[model samples]
Target chain A: MATIRDLARRCGVSVATVSRVFNNPDAVTRETREAVLRAAALLGYTPSAPARTLATKRSRMVGLAWDTGHRGPGWRHPFLQELLVGLKTALSERGYHLLMLATGEDADGHLRAVRRHSLDGVVFIDDGTADPALTRLAESGVPCVSLDRPVTGRRATYVTSDNAGGAGAAVRHLYERGRRRIATIAGPGRTHPGAERLAGYRAALAALGLPLRDEYVVEGDFYLGGGHAAMRRLLALDECPDAVFAAGDEMAVGAVRAALEAGLDVPGDVAVAGFDDIEPASLVRPALTTVAQDRAGFGAAVAAALISMIDDPDAAAPPPTVLPVRLVVRETSGPPRAG
Target chain B: MATIRDLARRCGVSVATVSRVFNNPDAVTRETREAVLRAAALLGYTPSAPARTLATKRSRMVGLAWDTGHRGPGWRHPFLQELLVGLKTALSERGYHLLMLATGEDADGHLRAVRRHSLDGVVFIDDGTADPALTRLAESGVPCVSLDRPVTGRRATYVTSDNAGGAGAAVRHLYERGRRRIATIAGPGRTHPGAERLAGYRAALAALGLPLRDEYVVEGDFYLGGGHAAMRRLLALDECPDAVFAAGDEMAVGAVRAALEAGLDVPGDVAVAGFDDIEPASLVRPALTTVAQDRAGFGAAVAAALISMIDDPDAAAPPPTVLPVRLVVRETSGPPRAG
Candidate 1:
């Protein structure tokens, strides 16, 4: 518990010199800096983080704000775990610790948490476009980054996966398999991913010269139950689709389960494709054919964007970053069935 | 941003009186407190968290430390997510935020992180018993609660599930089905759950007058791959087990996959059981029959223990709380096949 004054006295230097050595070593002479460091080492004097934060107005901590109020279909999805792993790794490398701020019942819970804690920056995941809190946070001068959902009229940097492109790939892959009747379990059109993925499904069908059948398209909540119900509806159709594409892996797994319970062999009766190559996608019976978005890359990019904004608050807003996605064909979506 | 001095001047009180009103309101008169509060509200004066920590030596923040170095078999398991949801719920109710501290490459990473941040308490999950860092943290006088992994000699509050009892239940359920030769996929012995579950498996066999065959027991990492490999090894044996119990649900799912891939029917040929009762256990084909631990209860118990300790550090070490477990019968471990 040695103080700066004690170090200054032990090193035979003024208190200001000792303080300068710790805060701005370049401003102090090399010899004086070495003397102050040696004295600090000998005396077991460590700089207090709170004191430094008070002086520098920097906490070196980042807030990860997410809305946990809704228990949606994607609640148990594994993509979140992968994203966290990546975000934690990148943040740790930069000497930052993640403070998880769950947006509680109140609409402004996240904003309250951010204000209570002195965070250098914040990263919001799944923040819809119309949250007035985001605008207030941006106006409060906190560097911000939005993931999955883009924020308009705010200086917050946006990072997301190539949802539209990945969805299109899934559709084309299904079409190339010679499945004349293709169905889709589209996600809710409220969120960015849901809207983009649904659009991709429609665009791909049009591009492939296939008529978009309204009865073949079912809107789902990007969850297993939704997929199961949607698949049941598809089965009741006069001409059942030979292939089904789900906007998410969880939904696809649900669809697979529904088909099996109906005594139908997957890929033999109906091909299934999904987005987000989560771990469960591979563990499921007929390993899911999915659009593999690099969850780790997405997390790292978001963290990097927020860190850069924190470092240079006045820097021009960087263009939104969209990570690429690739198709992973597994047992669920095999070769096209014979005519 | 109004300071205490400004509030004191506006309220016609001394600076010490205003400070006392904020830090120890009980020491001030009701009239004085009301006047100080009114002045503070009018001046828009808010107490800074760091400055309050400097005075009261409490951060009102909790640190969650876990080992991420080993990408072990349980890396993608759903138990952590369930536990986190529970912990977050409990912590939020107590007006606390979770600070995720990832233990990096350095063995003392957690310790350094703890020391740098002003955490009122900490909750350590899955930290090995042999970590000297835990002892150091205990000696550092920070209130701590260990989850799943019990740490001895540290006076730390311990909370865990009834692993042995749960495993015994799974075994007895298999025995009731008249399975003669039962096998077990045990978790790594280093972890508390792994060792306790193995003990339960052995105790159950002894109680049932069944032989504990060494070949019937295989060590796994509580992951899907480990279970798959262990099952493969069992299939190669001259006397393959009629029923298999995996220490974790993921491992059980893997075992089921292996049996199916080898053209064997689940329950009809080789019944399979698992522990944890994760979401996948019910979703996987055949719906794995397993032991169910109350994940949310465990999390809440741990959070409550830490909060109590933080509130009164001098309170006698409460006995470690062990939540009960139950057997959830599903499709996988059905009645033994007719001989």
Candidate 2:
């Protein structure tokens, strides 16, 4: 209930003197500043966060800008729960609370929203969609770090799993299992992860001396329905592939269901592999074999890079941080049991 | 980039007049307010959120007070991801941003934190831990709605799944499967859900002309290890139970795993059921039969109640809203297939 006037009156000073003591202490005598501060403490006249931000140009709040609503309706990050756990744990230890900013109708609107909120910095969740607005924001001077997408800016960086490497490993893992006729349910090429993983799949087939048949690759939208349709297409090919790899686990789950619905035993007739070993991967029947990204580690790394950008405005934008991924050999793609 | 002085100069008004136009428009003349507003629009000198909060004591922010860190380490809400998606969708529609307030060391600190952040209201995630801080917060004048718990205050209400109804249904379903000697993995009695679910189990047995065997009721922490340990204890009894109902899905999964490891068939040797039909329930082998809560609906209801309270300060605290839940019959607790 106490105001600046109360503090000023209690300390026998003008309101401006009280303000200067809190905002620009050097403008007042040391004794006067101390007396005002002591009075402020006594009267519980603590400055508000907004006032402090206006004075210091910093709010201990990080803006979380996610593009899910615009990218694709109902498109959820596979391991988002774990990602949040990681982000909150790391951000809390560093004394910053995440203030999720709305992904407005346009690029400039997002910038305006951030300014209105007066966020210190932002962590953008690039939903692997080639968003022009996200691209423009990345080029802005506001300190930021993105997830699963790359951008070029004076103070911008991105972090993602080794998409290319994981895709190639999935292909190689299938090849090592003696399935030369391998097909893939690839994601859309517009996304960074999609493009990179597709290139990796192609490169892996070339290295293995297997002809990359055009019909073997089906483009998907990293969703279950897309994967099921893509798999149906792959299954209907003239020469059905003996093995399949999906760029994402959701599609892989869909693929497996499509195969089972067609009365084909998984790993017995057509081996299957997926990326992003989310929870459903292990829970599904014949558990899915997939590329496992360090979900929590990815979130933590994003927090670290963004904090670095926030703390040092003059620091150069760091290079894209690529987290490692490994193959989880579950029943869906593992070797058959001994007879 | 334009300051109040810049705006005043552009509008040919005093600096105090420019402030008055934005802060206390009623005090300014219509012509002068229009002139200041035009200048503000031209000069891009909009008042910030903090400034607006200071002037009008309202922030379009809802504090998300979760007691996870203070509760048991590594305890996660089974359907947190969905709950958040629900909350975000509803909050965004109403033009409110969720500000996750950190659960500090004690109760009063939470109040201080809310005040420091200038939050308009709070949503306390009472993690069924009998938290004193959460209780105190609900009792405060700050508009708040709790999840999975209840409290009494002038502007406080809570929303939760029908724990008792869900639990009673789980027990009755097990009985329908011809398993009368049912055991239970109840959560801590100090919490609401745990206590209600346990009470339901007791009532269901008595209603079915069965005794409430003390040894058949084991206390669990609504966790996997706790469920596994409780199941092992029941299995070791001289007259082992033919069915088990866990208060939580995580614990039910543990119970199922333990039963399988002990060479018992789920829903055959020992029919099992769980609550909170989360994602893993359907994916698990012999899929878990559990109580399904409307996860997103829970968040939406919480938001609706909290927003109502915030918008209507004089409104009495609404009674605790209990959302309906249903039993999901799966391979884990369903009747055997006809030969």
Q: List the residue pairs that clash in candidate 1.
A: none
Restricted to chain B, the TM-score per model reads: 0.88, 0.85
Tell me the tens digit of each residue's lDDT in model 2 across B199-252. 999999998988889999999988878999999999999999989999998889
Per-model DockQ against the true two-chain complex: 0.55, 0.46
Model 2: runs farther than 4 Å from truth?
A1-47, A103-109, A175-179, A225-242, A258-270, A314-316, A337-339, B1-46, B70-73, B103-109, B152-154, B176-181, B232-243, B258-270, B312-316, B337-339
How far out, in Å, is residue A150 in model 2?
Answer: 2.6
Report the number of the highest-DockQ candidate: 1
Q: State, as a TM-score between 0 and 1, how close model 2 is to the true structure.
A: 0.84
Residue range A197-292, candidate 1, lDDT tens digits: 888888999999999999989988878899999999998899999899999888899998888888888998899999988777887778899999
lDDT score, candidate 1 = 0.81
The structural similarity of chain B in model 2 to the true chain B, as TM-score, is 0.85
Candidate 2, CAPRI quality class derived from DockQ: acceptable
Q: Per-residue lDDT tens digits of candidate 1, residues B1-339?
A: 677888888888898999899779999999999999998868657666566665666777788876554444236534777677788778888877788887665666665566556777788865344467766775566778887777654447788889899999999999898787899999989878899999999999999999999999999988888999999999889999999999999899989999988989899889999998877677777888999988779779988888888788687556789999999999998876576
